[model samples]
Target: MTKDVEMAARNGSNGAVAGEAYYPPPPAQGGDVDVDDDGKQRRTGTVWTASAHIITAVIGSGVLSLAWATAQLGWVVGPVTLMLFAAITYYTSGLLADCYRTGDAHTGKRNYTYMDAVASYLSRPQVWACGVFQYVNLVGTAIGYTITASISAAAINKANCFHKNGRAADCGVYDSMYMAVFGVVQIFFSQVPNFHDLWWLSILAAVMSFTYASIAVGLSLAQTISGPTGKATLTGTEVGVDVDSAQKIWLAFQALGDIAFAYSYSMILIEIQDTVRSPPAENKTMKKATLVGVSTTTAFYMLCGCLGYAAFGNGAKGNILTGFGFYEPYWLIDFANVCIVVHLVGAYQVFCQPIFAAVEGFAAATWPNAGFITREHRVAAGKRLGFNLNLFRLTWRTAFVIVSTLLAILMPFFNDILGFLGAIGFWPLTVYFPVEMYIRQRGIPRYTTRWVALQTLSFLCFLVSLAAAVASIEGVTESLKNYVPFKTKS
Candidate 1:
């Protein structure tokens, strides 16, 4: 049985590569071996399930901010930039997928996570670098989601307060208090035993994503047609060309960063791909799933961004939902806020799983007998009842949630943080590693036209990411000047 497990891991179900030259780390610990009680393999998800997972991960609070992003760039640049990023991401996603298998389909080995792929195709130094950025991106994303969810909760509470009173009410439920409540909810769902167990949640979250996005677009279009309640003005014209060129450039670059962040799902591509059923046609399955997910998300982005800018114009808040104000259709506004909170819960988990996997894998690798790999708990009717929870797992996972919750409470600059994370992460996770690994995997010669073009793209992404990072820092600093921590404004 043990030998069979080893053989199965070595000869991945996916037939992309053909040699046993590249072997993954031990599976008994945490290297992507799904075995039953009797030690046989277990097949899990389909292409649609995978697509749902990708969609759930990709589309989150990012979509909510697109209207503002559009407002920053105006209609012409907004939609075009988004479409361009979509194309770039799709192309890079294909590159990442191709790196999943190491041998031929019949006997090829598979990379279970992003770091795994990096270690296999790239150098150890690259692996360490990738691991740091990937985990940072995931943890940072989880923190962002926590903040967004709390904001949604706060918005809902604020709306109810306004309904009870004649004006906006100080509900005493600031972002921190809401985050505390949200932390408890995340703690429960975060304990779901495995990635496979969360697919249903992902599907529901995908549905929720489409639901709120459609509502947002519908509301914006209606508002636009009826004439905007707030003063409406075009982007470039509102600021005027007479304004400081430096300030105009700063805003433009910041918008570029936001758009980049909106498409920042490359960090978790391998982790999502890892969930597919073995004999996994990773290349084909993931490609198809990426197309479906990206296409769906792109449609939503374009509609919400263009229509939202049209409705609110330069008056759009960082979150378009907030721009709806406590108006006549207050019920729909509340429902939309509720949906955002719900979707964020799922988004938090989709990213965190990779972090959990990476940490557990490291623990297992370091201490072979620590029981950190896979421990058996009680079993139910032919099924595993609960997770293989241990002191390390419980302690670290709980601490992670607590820390992220705290960060969300402390620094609630949603758009600024999103831009910062995207800027810092874009170069390494999105462009550099993927392109470099692809060159090595495909054995593309240096200085060739294809190589030069890809390299130039990577360099461009790096420069833009750096500029975005600086701009994000400035934005955060400026926001902090007005921020009164833990205080709820009436």
Candidate 2:
């Protein structure tokens, strides 16, 4: 096992990375049928299963913001931006998948996580940078999910309130309380051992994503066909009419960040790839999965975003599902919000598992003799379902949940926070590191045609990220003028 990637502290399971002592050993396997190159349980993730995981991670929370993002970009740029991100994500993700193995594409040692991949190809400084950016983004994502799930939960109540007390009802939604509830729910799911134990949950979350996204799309299409839609133009919102030139620029840049955020999951690409079994090679399987996943997500995004802009035009709500874009068929709207909450529950774990593993793994490795870090007590719950409880994991994970929940309560500016996270994470994790690692692993010479082209692409993306980050900060600053801490309205 590589020192850079001893992501778990516990002994045994040669290929294991992330979350110590939680994995069930391979079930009495024979031959190489159920074993990996590192001689642990052969990963059972196929292209479809991998695609499901990708969809689960990519589609939640971000999809809800697409309508407003599209409105900012207008008809011409909105759809174009979506395709551009899909293309960039697919291309760079392909580059990353090839870096799964250290030396050769097939038989080289595995790099199980994103930081592991960076540590394999880059120097110590770059490795440290990757760890900071990747882990921070993962924790940020956990916060974003808590905020989104609570918004959806509150939206359900708001919808019901409006249905009962007329459309003008002041449906008071307590976001802090809902955020706390979401935190409590995450505490339980956070205990779900490791990455490999997440297939079924990811599948369920993927289904929920499709369900809510499809509902939003169908509603938007209906509104589009019903006539009397809001103002729309090829160039998007007019500078003098909808916003000042400065506001226009900021909103457009923030819209770019939103789109970038929607295509996130590149930070965890290597981790996702690690779950795939070999034979066709992890890279090959991951590439196929990325194609299927990105294409599927792109198609749905087009429907949800473009149709939404058509329906509501420049007035598109920040979150189509929970932002009151659709009110009729209150039951369906409620169901859609419910699905969003459910989908985010699974997506939350998908991102948080890496963080949990990094911390718990370090604890176990640092103090090999510490029973508190290594011990597990199997406990039975209602219906007698069995699970493990580790003292350190329980304390640390609960604290993380509580902290994220509190942050969500303090700053519930959903779109601004998502844009900020997206802008900061998009360039380095998604584009730069992958491009650099690919060049180094393939030994592409500096200033060569391939190297120059890759560098040019990265530079352009860096510019985009810089602009979006600035815009997000400005948006958050603007939001602060009327903001009251721990009080978020729907």
TM-score of each prediction: 0.88, 0.93
Provide the lowest-lDDT 10-residue window in model 2: 12-21
Q: On residues 113-213, what C-alpha lDDT tens digit does candidate 1 reach at each position?
A: 77778877887778778878888888889988888888888888777777787575555466888889889898878776457678989998888888889
Supply the global lDDT for candidate 2: 0.85
| C-alpha lDDT values of all predictions | 0.76, 0.85
The sequence of per-residue lDDT tens digits that candidate 2 reaches over residues 1-490 is: 2221232344322222322223433322254335676755568899988999999999989998999999998999999999989999999999999988988788998876787788778887898888888889998999998899998898889888888898887888889989999999999888777788889999999999999999999988887898668788887888999888999999999999988999999988887887888788889999999999999999999999998888888988889875444367889999999999999999999998878776766677677556687666667676546676778888999899999899889989899999989999999999999999989888899899999999999999999999999999999999999999877776
- Provide the clash count, candidate 2: 0
Error of 1 at 456 (Å): 1.7
TM-score of 2: 0.93
- Report model 1's TM-score to 2 decimal places: 0.88
Clashing pairs in 2: none
